[model samples]
Target chain A: AQSVTQPDIHITVSEGASLELRCNYSYGATPYLFWYVQSPGQGLQLLLKYFSGDTLVQGIKGFEAEFKRSQSSFNLRKPSVHWSDAAEYFCAVGSAEGYSTLTFGKGTMLLVSP
Target chain B: EAGVTQFPSHSVIEKGQTVTLRCDPISGHDNLYWYRRVMGKEIKFLLHFVKESKQDESGMPNNRFLAERTGGTYSTLKVQPAELEDSGVYFCASSQGYGETQYFGPGTRLLVL
Candidate 1:
């Protein structure tokens, strides 16, 4: 079974500061990774995805994630944080054989301080 | 184009009561998915629908939960005689087809007391 582990429960960062949310996964084969953000009273939005090439994938809102095959990790990072970027971040893993049904992590809640 | 939309954003009901949740996926999206997030838990896949057919329902908790997409349009998930453990946020998502990013809808929060 493929599982995603987001070790951070909640992370607080000052506005304009760099931010990084760690995500680790355990899968048998090449994995499809994704990062999603959910704001209060809103739906989850895709931040980025990693499937084949390009170990580092860029997403909307200046977010980027690097997929390390050896580390089995796909961590999300941003050069600067904004108050509007405060939301819940989830790391999910899926397999091509699984028909793309995702198995998500427990999620990390991000709080940006002004 | 309109994103996925779910009806009755929040619902509070007593245990053993029936609750039905509806979802309208994005226009022309052929794949619809159902997922849920229990309190303090990760969002989990409940099922997947390809058009009007049940492509995969292995994630559904039990027989009490029934989901249908009539005429390959709007989909409904009905939980009959809901249990207290069923309290959670139910999310609906859609995609143009297989191997595509799924667009999500604002979830329906169900509280079973």
Candidate 2:
């Protein structure tokens, strides 16, 4: 079974500050990792994904994540956060061998302050 | 392109009542999925449908929940005799094919009182 763990329940960052959201996973093999953001009253939007290749993957909205195989982690990062970036973020893992059904982490709520 | 869509953005029902949620997947998408997020809990998978066929339903909670995808188009999830524990946001997603990236719909929030 694949499981995702996000250590932070909530995080606040000032505008223009660099931000990082931690995520860890447990899977049998190389898993398909993803970061999704859910704004208020909206659906989850894909931020980025890591299937293979480059460890650092870029995503929409100036977001990026690094896949660390040694640590079993895929952490999302941004060089600078804007106030509009405040939202709920989820880290998910899917089986590369199966139907790609995702196992999501308890989301971390981000609050961007000015 | 149109995204996955769900009906009845919010539903408030009595504990013993029944509620049915609907989902319209993106056109040409053959894979549809149902997921839910209970308060303070991680979003959990409920079921997966591959063109009207049940690919996986191991995540379904109980028999009280029934899901159907007629003609392999839109899907519906019916919950009978709802409980407070069932109060949460139910999301529908669709993908072009197996192992592809899924597009999610704005979830339907169900509150059982």
The TM-score between candidate 1 and the true structure equals 0.98
Give the lDDT of residue B51 in candidate 1: 95
Error of 2 at B13 (Å): 0.5
Prediction 1 global C-alpha lDDT: 0.94
Q: Which ten residues in a row have the lowest lDDT in candidate 2 chain A?
A: A93-102
Lowest summed lDDT across 10 adjacent residues in model 1 chain A is found at A94-103
Deviating ranges (above 4 Å) for candidate 2: none
- A1-114 per-residue lDDT for model 1 (tens digits): 889999999999999999999999999977889999999889899999998898999999999999999999999999999999999999998885545488899999999998
Q: Write the per-residue lDDT of candidate 1 for residues B1-113, one digit (tens) a residue.
A: 79999998999999999999999999999999999999999999999999999998989999999999999999999999899999999999999978678889999999999
- Per-residue lDDT of A21-109 in model 2, one digit per residue for the tens? 99999999879999999999899998999888999999999999999999999999999999999999999998776664899999999
Give the runs in model 1 whose Cα sits over 4 Å from its true position: none
